[model samples]
Target: MSLAPSSAPARMPGWLLILPALLFLVAFFVLPLIDNSLRSFEVGGEFSLGRYIQLLTDTFYLGVIVETVVLSTAVTVICALIGYPVAYYLVRHAGRWSGLIVFLLIAPLLTSIIMRTYGWQVLFARRGLVNTLLVQDLGILERPLQLLNTPGIAIAALVHVLVPFMVLSIATVLQGIDQRLEEGAQMLGASRWRTFLEVTLPLSADGIGTGAILVFMIANGSFVTLVLLGGGFQTLPLFIYQQFTTTRDFGMASTMSTILLVIAMTCLYLQLRLVRRAGV
Candidate 1:
């Protein structure tokens, strides 16, 4: 026999509160994704495998996808390399100076991304401020560096944009760590270096992995940074934009976007696996 209505556990309003969010997600994200996916499989507005076949056979599209993934990976690695120490210092060393350091970490993130990209534009351009400083003031070089329009500069700019995300993800994990653990390690004849390697790094692996995934995803999906710095290097984002807007082929763009979605989902899955294994 079914239980009476009143015998059922009273449900919390947390779900009720989230109903609007759920609705919005369905309306926006779910619908758009479904439509895009449908479009990716279509030819002339009907179901077909032509789009997928075309994408697979197209060498240019493949190159664009590879370039985007590689650039994003580079950005993620750079952000992790630089962001870890900054996060570590904020979590471990800074006490009264924590507020100041945190602000310094957050200031760039707070600025508009467009503004940041423009800053890079000015810095990296031939005869720009960086070139002038390097050649005239620092005497590091006799000529202005051609830094404005290369894959390396694009990656560098993207890294600058992405580093803070890595730092924030790492900072959260660092904050959660017990300070006494390090003290205990010190008492047990472990030097600071050994303690960090043995205790801190292992424990902070989840955060590092999370940050890497976040940065990598952002870098992979980037359009503005690549367009401005790449100067027509043709990443997936720029390619999609051109496909839809210039070439006026929404189908190809959607196919490319689907490929990107696949890549993002794979990265996310791997990140979750890593985090789970690390016991995060």
Candidate 2:
């Protein structure tokens, strides 16, 4: 053998390897957040809590906050309730109809949100299919009911858009669960419902928590859907937009943005804690 020393490739440190991503995060996300936080606190070249104080003290802003919370919670709950059964069916019966179901679930996401919302606009019109069916075909109503621009319609649109996320999340977790655990529970004289309650539900907590946090975060930040569906009913994001664009109040906009960020982070933290406590 030649007397050449064996050459080994040097391994990079983990931190060095991740430096680009860390730098990107700092440049884009972290720096923007810091800037916004500082801007929110800035008032007339001096630091103040006046923007936040106004947000908390004003009834209009408070109402928007409450509305945002309620809408987000309602959408999350509805998605969870509806998505579980669909996810379970997909996991348990993977061969038949699963592909079609998945296709339908993902099809809407591929389209533009504006186009989808406009489709809803068409359906919700006075002479739309819903009204046509109810009034002419079904004869359930003598006159077309005002269906558009209502809180109910807004919630429904949000649920339709977001439910797929919840379904996929839960289904992914459920697919990894061993079938023996569920069957064993059933064999122990437990009814199907009881077995599911005791065995299947507990293991799916992680997925549920993940989906809930995601849906809640997205719902709170909803702009286009709420504007198109709510029909003048304003939420926090709308409020922030108005502050920034219409009122040109940068301080208030930044403050509201920061508050929204806090709310999202707090909700995520609490959900993680709950999921951990549930042993998921």
Candidate 3:
């Protein structure tokens, strides 16, 4: 007996598949951004560039912008330097212990930021473990140093919090790299260090770029960490907070936000271009 031909189910269009997400983004993300951008340009119900002009001309705001860029750059560099070696080890040598190492790296991220920042406060307190070790056990100092509420400590905390992102980014890229490439380099009489510098390192540039972008963008917007540990160090985020809370100037705040967004987007574009070029 011949069976009737079965009909295939209708397939959904690609755009229809993503319609929900697109609608959600338009409602929440895009609309809010547009509103904020509009608010930034408005002056007494009329549109103007006064806010932008004022921010660009003002020395204090310019200084904050510079400081924010510098702080983020420093954090990104430190994360890259610290993460690359760990990532290399994790990819090439961790073997059976890789899961444990990854857990250790990600564990801190699972904790609340407030809790982590407070933990840093506890460690840097007058009689905290760090001070105790330096003053009592090691006798490195006569008195406990004022380690809390300092720029250096803030940077260290940022690095500690962000290094895992860098490590994971690099590790992912490293996993895709062929071991035989390195083997061939060494087989060609290249020293291990030379092979790493010439071959492995070049191959991992995309990861470094990705990690650097992540770290830089995050450090740019870090608020609580800087507020608790930065000792009055000003950045765009801090200034934005002040504009909202202290002065209640929504226009100025939105203007600064737009500027910060532009800076971040510029960096992202540049990094993506570099990664693409490297891939080529």
lDDT of each: 0.84, 0.86, 0.89
Q: Which sections of candidate 3 miss by over 4 Å? A: 1-14, 267-280
lDDT of 1 by residue, 1-280 (tens): 2243345446543346568999999999989998898888988767999878877778877788777887777788889999999999888789899999878878988888789889988887898898999999999998998888877777777888889899999999999989899899999999989999999998888889899999988887888777666655777888887887779888889988888989889989998887787676
Candidate 2 stretches with Cα past 4 Å from truth are: 1-17, 267-280
Task: List the lowest-lDDT window of 10 residues for candidate 1.
Answer: 1-10
Among all windows of ten consecutive residues in candidate 3, which has the lowest summed lDDT? 1-10
Residue 91 lDDT in model 3?
A: 96
Residue-level lDDT for 32 in candidate 3: 92
For model 3, what is the error of residue 252's alpha carbon versus the real structure, in angstroms, after optimal superposition? 1.1
Q: Per-residue lDDT of 2-25 in model 2, one digit per residue for the tens? A: 222233234433346568899999
Better of 2 and 3 by lDDT: 3
TM-score, candidate number 3: 0.89
Comparing 1 and 3 by lDDT, which wins? 3
Q: Candidate 3, residue 61: CA error in Å?
A: 0.7
Leading candidate by lDDT? 3
Q: Order the candidates by TM-score, highest first — what do you get?
A: 3, 2, 1
Candidate 3: tens digits of C-alpha lDDT, residues 94-140: 99999999999999899888898898999998899999999999999
